[model samples]
Target: MNKLIAWIVFLSLALGGCATKVSTSFDRQADFSRYKTFCWLQGCEFTFTGPSYMNDSAVVNNLKNAIIKEMAEKGFTYDDQSPDLLLDFHVTVENRQTNVYRFEEDRFLQLDPIDQSDVYYFLEGTLIMDIADRETGQMIWRSSASRYLELNPEMTERNLRKGIGIVLKKFPPKER
Candidate 1:
């Protein structure tokens, strides 16, 4: 009996711990998938067309390098005037509120004890990236990644890279 119980407990724990840590809300791969391939262009080096409110030089440099690496890996070349896609980016940090509650039931209702917390929000500095058509100068593609923003620099950078990669996975739409 003791051995059987131990075996069951061990199996239960192992099974539970093996679960995935990824979010269960949306099939991340399928979300906004309809817009995966916005336009077909290549090797378009993006410029820092936006501003970074963080004022952290290290962070900025890190972002630039990460983006360049990612773009290069995707075989996208960068040019100033005749480039297939005009690349530009920015970084922003904003202060925002999370959850708010009221002590309505208690006598504290009169006192109005509302608690607030301070958190750093990191959005993909460039709220929008306009991928223009070299021939017509038309905005062929527009991408946006809005996030609560991570506080740690490394975390922030990682999040930015991941967000961009995920968004661009479906770029250069394939013709059916």
Candidate 2:
């Protein structure tokens, strides 16, 4: 069991390694022509998809802080009571099952204690959404970003924030 668990962790860590590479295109695309002045409603909601967050294991503060900083610089104000734009996040963690078995002495052998181990994969992204005046409160404008995260708790927050920042940089939309 221990070995199997360890291997699972190892593989997850290997595949979920931090994203060291960086790209700085957020600002270049954050320009608005069709619409300029903006405001968030007074009572909007913020949320994320499952498996999109790191455990509260020390790096959460840094990750949250980075998001707040970048959003502010982009002219997005923080309003818990009211917000014109609703910030929502969607994430998915896939742990598809995989197994191996052997037969010996007319009996079958299981792969490991963790027989149904799986390959873990995840994606995290956020949407800055606004509801249109009519047409079922449709979307007005949105900015988003997403990326695979590393298994390391220490690396998760930073990578997630960076991903979010890059995605949101295109908010307000510019002619490209």
- Give me the candidate number with maximum lDDT: 1
Residue-wise C-alpha lDDT for candidate 2, range 1-176, written one tens digit per residue: 55455565556665564443322232343223423222233234333334534434444455455666666877766555434444443334444333332223223244233344344444332323232212224355444433444334244556656655675665555566
TM-score of 2: 0.45
Model 1 / residue 38 / CA error / Å: 15
Query: What's the CA error at residue 139 for candidate 1, in Å?
Result: 0.8
Estimated TM-score for each candidate: 0.50, 0.45
Question: TM-score: which candidate is best?
Answer: 1
Instruction: Give the poorly placed runs of model 2, Cα more than 4 Å off.
Output: 1-46, 52-64, 96-136, 142-146, 153-157
What are the root-mean-square deviations of the candidates from the true structure over C-alphas?
Answer: 12.2, 8.7
Evaluate residue 50 in candidate 2 and report its C-alpha lDDT on the 0 to 100 scale.
Answer: 43
